[model samples]
Target: MKKETQIGYRVSAICGAVALAFAGLHAMPAQAHGKNDVKHVLLISFDGLHEQDVARCIGSNACPNLALLAKSGVTYTNAHTPHLSDSFPGLAALLTGGSPKSAGLFYDVSYDRTLYAPLDSTCTGAQGWNVVFDETTGIDAKGGGPLINLDGGGAFNPDAIPYAKVGGVCTPVYPHNYIKTNTVFEVVKEHIRGSRTAWADKHAWGYDWVNGPSGKGVDDLARTEINSIDPKTGTYYLDTYTHTEVFDNIHVQALINEIDGLDSTGKTSAAVPTVFGTNFQTLSVAQKSPVADNGGYLDADFTPGPQVAAAITYLDGALGRVVSELKQRNLYSSTLIIVTAKHGQSPTDHTKLVKNGDTLTKLLEASNYLDSSGNFGQNNTTTGNLNDGSGLSGTGFVQTDDVGLIWLRDQSQKDAVVKTLKANLGCTAPGICADGPQAYILHGERLEHWFGDPANGRTPDIIVQPNPGVIYTSSKSKDEEHGGNAPDDSHLGLVVSFPGLHHGGRTDDRYVYTTQVAPTILSALDLDPDLLHSVQVEGTRTLPGLGIEHEHSQDRD
Candidate 1:
């Protein structure tokens, strides 16, 4: 048998469903992490954290814990997430060692022609559904209302799950099985005997992808609801930075509980996960909050306003708490803490934000690509409802934020649609603003080359990348948006901090992709990066300078 297959079979037998006891290594020693000495990989993602944000926060002393983390680790100044920086693919890259091409997660809300609609369970439908596994997939989404009950209404609702014919029977495709690649958690869990895996994030149902293919990768996934209604106020948990901080704190405490060798709720004692982390949304919420001076920089120089500054301060304090807990538990030296972002918000310069109403969709509708009432691609984060599919036009799917992603009812019309888009580059048509910024249309071979082919049933038939700072919505609530091809949208801050990583700290400016983090995590734990499907297929490598790679990104430990 092939070595990879053998390893998989062997580990699958060992890493069973039942929890196992971990050794008494807690009393081993408290020392700095050395090469090949990493036992725990703490991957922390500060969502919407930009490379410039880190540099400026450190220089300004606004983020002391972040500065210290950078001091003890190597910072990749030019690390970036996948193109068209949506959180689904962005986080997928960090944990799966793949891009949209290999990971097969185009966006959190995208179109798939091969899958039946959520309500279609008889193995029959038009064979296309707008895949929205966001907060709307939560149990509270039953009435098309706000996510009220916390804990994401007990995760994704059965009715909200998209079904398809697998083998010969129609079955629901969970987020864990939807993605094309295996994640670090899956590889680590299966490879390391008795080692636990855990994670915490903003979504309850939306983050199931972290579990990887087998759906058992994350032993403890804290389901903090980012969009649950604040019962006392009848507002979403994401309505204000203050509420967002509260939502983020629930997960932070969950991570602390995990470090304490307990479950995410601290109610049950469990083995500390071998691989674990959480993504913070305070910065993201701050950057996107529409309140005046609540987000974005004061200028192109990246000066933080009061709210952004406060958000960074909260993030630093949160990091400091984690560090202190690690030291208290003596896991500091044995843990490798990686700090980065799933994606970055755009238009760091608030002045550049251009908001308009549904121009791209209007253009497509006017061009006959979509019926007059047809709309597709419905992941609008600014909308009051979460995991919202109510706006789906039942004709086509076109999701827009800073970018326009279209999946046509008929894929053969892609060429003609592209022709119409090209003809209206200036968008002088009445459907679109004559004075609006021209967009770059990616269709046909070009779109397929970067992402996968549209024939895959998941890739958008066409993508529209407007000029930077142009958000597709005219909502007055947020200062920035993501999911675009802009520099600010993709660029992210990356810091790999171990106890004694580089002695005095170092910075690597090489263009590294977030996909490398997955392989690097495995390498740190003395596991094989090739165990990951994407790492092997995409040639993803470990971060440079770690002893995990003798030659950096090549040559195993």
Candidate 2:
């Protein structure tokens, strides 16, 4: 048998032992309800959504279903994501009740200490630090020829991908196995009887990673491959007009099926999911489209272009379908609906858009911080191919979007590298750089203050924050991106609606983090929020202002 297969068996045995260790833990009573009330909790995420967009859509009557949800629950106007918000960290915060510090998740494509690149044979090769498990790495080359299976259920090949070494054992780090902490799904299943969880997401890879360590958190995982290449056309479907919008409907339909007690495969006799949800990418896609007014927002004013307006209408309609389904099944009053975003898009104002003249990679390459032969350009040919690790491990590896993160191999060169970066692109003042767009450089201990320390294995050594409208890429295909400290990226929409809340339709101005969602869900179900390992480490609290108390509160040792 192959080494990865043997390791998989060993890991499976370890997970089984861990599950058995906790199997005897008794289920807790429902805190906010009696034995017969509030049995289901549905959590939904709308990617790239901003709080202002939600207000604008509801105020202008562009989204009647969202307005109705707000009328029946509480809307948090000042809610925000972590300072350095990305989809991976954002979702981890929601499901783990912790920030990147506690959850050990920064982005889908990030650095790791003990993981080896699949293409590298030395195991300690320079490319080993570069572990990517996204769509490109997880594509299934069978049946339809690179077509993503929405219901594949961890069907991707593990041996072909990079593996992470834990306790001297190397195991294929599939999406469902990457997370370092337990998710709300595991908490629900371990603490509640007959509790099954389901989720649908954009990629089959990163989304499945939410199953947490034991690899059994989510019962049904629907992988809607948004960027799959069409076998017949030999082109990426997401590049086509309104293709993502059409594909999003499939996930919404899956939610309906799950609510109706059908499996993601459309088979009956499946148990209804206790906690089920999916994400909407229409708004994010619309916002980034180069076409003006293509069903996305125009500027910070949130004036919906035709496409953005239509996307909002479509998402609102999807929510309406979920509500109608629950009501029809007499499950509406028993469900908790959460409307929020994984991350907000940047450059909300098109007029302020600035193409970075001197990219960070060029500056780093010139400084000898990057491999001399490596193609550190916008294409990222070397890192993308997982080849030529040469300078990546010893020198440093830089990852960028709207923001930039640098992981250095030698701690002694930190001061020199930071000094060089400042000389090239550092801001003169808070947000004003000498050349190019305004930028802020954070290094040394400041990195730990904002995004934890590099010793944690996931935190970056240095962070680059540019002006709201500044982007590193020159690609004309997108107008805006996320992953920065700007208000446009950090601020997001958040709402919590339940049947027995004290106040409905009232807006709260409290400053709450998205990480609070995990603990709150546990509390609502009468399960201890501290059951989530990260929650205990971070002391994350349940979202306040819901006017409901958890039945029991205990800290996990």
Candidate 3:
């Protein structure tokens, strides 16, 4: 009845399907590794992390644990994620060795024609926004109603969204539905021998794939508590809590449990999962956690810089705990550890940006440029459609902190939209919008590079590039934000600490991108690069200081 209940039922069905599928696959005994064989890989993602933060921690001696890791490991200075580095897209590239081109993950919640409707089309007509489908609804689109329909059925509590009042519905598209390709974990499990895998994370983009022990490569893991669909009859349900809490409490606890099992079971010889990861709740801590950001009603802020620092310390402690456990069990030195982030955040001051003198906002309002709902770019007003090329009026527009995604008012209006934007918002006037390096009019090859399917859903006419100091926020604009292509959001940290590393203590400024993370991991594991489906994107070469000798003859390859 309730949407939450339906979500639970759907999650259970997926797990059931996974179990059935796994049962059909042949099972094999755990393989033992020869002496000196690397036994573990630990990958951790720090949400909203900048390269400077790592450097600051090292310089300030604030992160002693990470410092020790840096001293022993290789710290890559030029690692980066692709432009417009959002979490889902960034992680998609990290795990799949591809961009939106192959991964089909363009944004935090992108459109999927086969599995789910695009966000704008998924919702019921009156809801004003598109409906995001749930598993219970299935592909047929049955049993979906205003979110009230699900909450009314006693599925999930309606306290968060006021679905009863606004007729809102939240049908999350699961990871399997979102990702179109296999990840490095899946490849490793399928091809490698005598290896086990595990993962933990709060975000659906990364760890949800590892929910159960089947398709997800993790032999043991924790997913964002399963989405509950059935209040009383559902088979699976994550306790109602925020993702940050789940990551800090349940996900981290699950990792600890796995470590404890490995230690107590004396199962070092038992094929242990070679790859394991956990993404700490740094964003929530930095912007909202310990405080609810007015129950998700306020804009994001970097005001809690100290809280972010505290979270970093806490996560480092967790890292120490895991590493200590491994060492106590005599498995530490053999493991390869990596620390990085999905992307970084930008500093924005909504208070200053919203004043009448906020030239950019005034420009949009003067041009009769209405967002999705026929309203001019109003202050603190979100959830409007953009200038979509659809016949609908006011189809596309900008909202929040200056980030605009244009939905053409008609298919023919695309050119007009581009022309109007380049002329009106082209940074010429004091009141016009400012375009950053990340902001560009994608067409032809560039558009195709980011979206495999441009026909159904890729992006709108233009992606409003947030300036370096701006972020996209809901209420009160924001104090800080991401979703831009600034160096802060794109530049990331890459730390590789393992035996056989060149003690060269070298830091090369060579260009590297997130597309290289997967290949790097696979290469570290002594696996073939081709297996991960990586094509050596421009500037994506191997790490230089790994002590793994590369022949100059084959270097051209």
Candidate 1 structure quality by residue, lDDT tens digits, 388-494:
33334235688888888888877878879877776665533333322344457778787888888888788888888877887877688887999977888988999
Q: Ten consecutive residues with minimal summed lDDT in candidate 1? A: 4-13
lDDT of 3 by residue, 200-294 (tens): 55432233433222355555444332232323443322222233443365455555555555521234433446777766654434543222232
Estimate candidate 3's alpha-carbon lDDT, on a 0 to 1 scale.
Answer: 0.48
Query: What are the per-residue Cα lDDT tens digits for candidate 2 across 131-159?
Result: 55555444463222454444333466442
Clashing pairs in 1: 136-386, 136-387, 290-477, 290-478, 376-397, 376-398, 377-397, 377-398, 377-399
Which candidate gets the maximum TM-score versus the true structure? 1
Give candidate 3 misplaced runs (Cα > 4 Å).
Answer: 1-36, 112-174, 204-216, 219-221, 225-249, 262-271, 287-304, 348-411, 426-432, 435-445, 449-453, 534-540, 547-557
Regions more than 4 Å wrong, model 2: 1-36, 119-128, 141-154, 157-160, 230-237, 291-296, 375-395, 426-439, 553-557
User: What lDDT score is found at residue 31 in candidate 1?
Assistant: 19
Cα error, residue 314 of model 1, in Å, equals 0.3
